[model samples]
Target: NLRALFGYMWAHPGKKLLFMGGEFGQRREWAHESSLEWHALGMDQRHEGVSRWVADLNRVLREQPALHQKDFVNDGFRWVQRGDWEQSVVSFLRLGNEAAPPILVICNFTPVPRLNYRIGVPRGGYWRELLNSDAPMYGGSGLGNYGGCEATPMPYEDFSHSLSITVPPLAALFFKPE
Candidate 1:
């Protein structure tokens, strides 16, 4: 989804993205092609959730230094792996200045709860949950773990360190070291 790409653009502004039609607040998918029912706004959480996610992506891109900075190619970004593609769970790293704290980006696409999904952290330290698409305000299932970081060394040795977090389907999350 645009969330991941937009998040990357947040860290790497020079990159460009092209979202297909009906992506922004536009409801009524291809099936109900009736001029995008404007009333869809008040009908359900789907449009609202899309709008919020897009807004949040822009906000993070503009507000965070790791995202706002210009040197994203060589010094800013890297991809982190998730277990499944259909699940739509993906992650990436936003590198800061020398020794500066790196940020972690994660997105979960499954509708069901994903428990014990291992997301490797680059360095060993306390990482805090910065943004979660599963938050109650984001029109999600609200099934996620927050305010913690992976502390064990077993997975850290291989750079595939994982955090014990729950992922709601079609959600995104951002984490940063404290």
Candidate 2:
């Protein structure tokens, strides 16, 4: 769930702020005098996984122009799926300038895995799965689209093309066209 939250924040248009201990899922409240729970990383795999996940998120944010180029612009973001309260799923596209490829961000808030979930896209081609919060490296169930998924000609939602993907339980995914 922490990964999903972080993924959403990272994908969302805005500046980001991570407190000292948040990168590793520190459970306790922050104290001015006390140091972060550094030992937790050595004690539990989850702590390390979260730390690594944050690092990857940072890397992706830096590498993908679509994520940061239009941080405060109305034209930068578009929703593909929303208002699905019962399923607790949301998906959107983040756009940059004309040169930058749009990124698809999907979040599954429920605990149940959503298999073969189709999502609409603006263009058709190979959409690389740039990030998956449910990957085993992130202390998750290792459910993903095996790197990425190709958009088919079949229309879905509001787009002319679509890609069927596996949205892991309580996970967020990022995809970019190739």
Candidate 3:
């Protein structure tokens, strides 16, 4: 699913650029002699949805300085929640431009929707959901926070504020402070 794909891209460091035919879940092996199976996109809605999601991700990475700046620097990233290997969830922040707010990325690798998922945040403010892999628009189950979440003044994961959010099954969520 696009969830895992986007998760790996946003979680890891460095510029994100995939190989040809990779965005739409290319099934066949890589071949230098043949063209990509572009026709397969029309074969099912999932492929088209994945293509759209990837485009959106690229647009976001380009538009949001918090997601792009300081790519190789460790200061640009911070962990908000982790050590939940049984549930396979990890939450982190990506700080780009210094003046701007950081981006929060939460991933649910397991196939279990975690409702009311509390995660630590940098501050107690409104955070917008920039992208949700579980949204129906991306051919998912549409299980996710409506749009954004507000962090309460509760200590969480070493942060003074925390947000009880919704992490859909096998999905990756992106949130930006606003």
Candidate 4:
């Protein structure tokens, strides 16, 4: 759940901030007197996974212009799927300048795995899965789209292109055109 929350924050528009103990999934309350639980990373794999996931999100934020550029503007974000309350899934696209490729972010709030979930995209081509919170390294069940999914011409939502993807339970997935 921490991974998904951070993923959504990174994908959402505007600035970013992380509380002191959030990077490594600190279990205890924050205390200015005591130092961060650095030993937690070595104690559990899940803690290390959260740290690694935060690092990746930071790297992606720096490397991908679509994530940071034009974040303060309304045109930088677009909704691809936001009405699926029954499935508890929401997907959106983040846009940068004209030169940068748009990024698609999907978040599944439910604990049940959602298979064959179709999401609309602006273009039709190979959409590479840049990050999957459900991967084994992230202490998840290793359920994902196997690195990427190809967008087809079949129109499902408002867009002409769509990709059939497997959304892991209580996880978020990030993709970009390749």
Candidate 5:
């Protein structure tokens, strides 16, 4: 099960989980060890949606200068939150040096919608939507609004303010400064 596998690996240090296709319980399985069933794509749109979501996620992990610029666990990696059932969301922050910009990454695992959600982001001016899992390109039903991003104020954590946004069901989002 992708859910069980993900939770297990998420807790184990230095362990990574890779699924063959969109095996995150979108309601299907890989067929007879051949090529990906392009037709089975019709059985469940969540498969295509979640697959694109994961692909975009990998692209972000690989290309984002702030995320890949240094060691993830060392420089700015921090688990800001978690939930009881472990069907939870997580957050990460990437702090900048003298010249670069700070970034925030948020992931959600809830099967239902999360609204008016707030998180602590580094103090800054406008932040841009680096990527969103709810976008139509990912096969999601596209319940998200604002194709781009709006301005986020600074000092948003204590020294920060409330960072407000909505998280569509089973989605992830990345943010970078504009």
Candidate 6:
């Protein structure tokens, strides 16, 4: 659920915030009176995996232009699909400056997996999977797009190019042109 939320937030402008220890799946509520339970990571592999994912996302946000550049500008974001509330799914694009290509983010908050989910793109190329919350390492069911997929000229969601992607159950998938 956190990954899905993060994906949704990444598509929008302004800042994205994560409280301390929340990124690594801190089970207990935080208290200002004490330090975090650092031992949880040692005790559970799941916790470690969550930490790794958080680190990866942080790196992506810093390194990817689409995620950071023009974040405060409304032009930095665009919705690919937003009427699928019934399916608990939403898709959007995070765009950088005009010189850079956009990054597409799709989120499936439902527990049902969606196959052949076609979403619009701003360009045609290899849509590399920058982040798959359903990867095995993230304590997910290992469902993913197998690294990347090629975009087709077929228009979808109001865009000239689109790509068919597999959206894992209760997961978020981030893609970038490569």
Task: Locate the minimum summed-lDDT window of 10 residues in model 5.
Answer: 4-13
lDDT of 2 by residue, 1-178 (tens): 8999999999999988999899999999999999999999999999999999999999999999999999999999999975667889999999999999999999999999999998899999999999999999999989999999899999888899999999999999999999
| Tens-digit per-residue lDDT, 83-163, candidate 5 | 324547666666544466655666667777667666666554556777666677766556653743454554443435336
- Candidate 1 per-residue lDDT over residues 35-54, each given as its tens digit: 55556657867666666766
Better of 1 and 5 by TM-score: 1
**Candidate 1 TM-score, C-alpha based:** 0.71
Count of clashes, each model: 4, 0, 0, 0, 6, 0
By lDDT, the better pick of 2 and 6 is 2
Better of 1 and 5 by lDDT: 1
130, model 4: CA deviation in Å? 0.2
Instruction: For candidate 4, report its TM-score.
Output: 0.98
Candidate 4 lDDT, 14-77, residue by residue in tens = 8889888899899998999999999999999999999999999899989999999988999999
lDDT minimum window of 10 residues, candidate 4: 81-90
Alpha-carbon local distance difference test for all models: 0.62, 0.94, 0.83, 0.92, 0.56, 0.84
RMSD of 3: 1.3
Residue 150 lDDT, candidate 3, scale 0-100: 90
Instruction: Report the lDDT of model 6 for residue 3.
Output: 61
Q: Model 2 off-target regions past 4 Å?
A: none
**Candidate 6: lDDT over CA atoms?**
0.84
Tens digits of per-residue lDDT for model 6, 1-178 = 7666665665567787778888778888899998888899999977887787778788888888888898888888888885688888888888899777788888899999999988889889899999998898877899988999999999986899999989999888889998
Native-vs-model 5 lDDT? 0.56
Off by over 4 Å in 5: 1-17, 22-44, 80-87, 95-98, 148-162
**Model 3 Cα shift for residue 52 (angstroms):** 0.8
TM-scores, each model vs. reference: 0.71, 0.98, 0.94, 0.98, 0.66, 0.93
Worst 10 contiguous positions by lDDT, candidate 1: 4-13
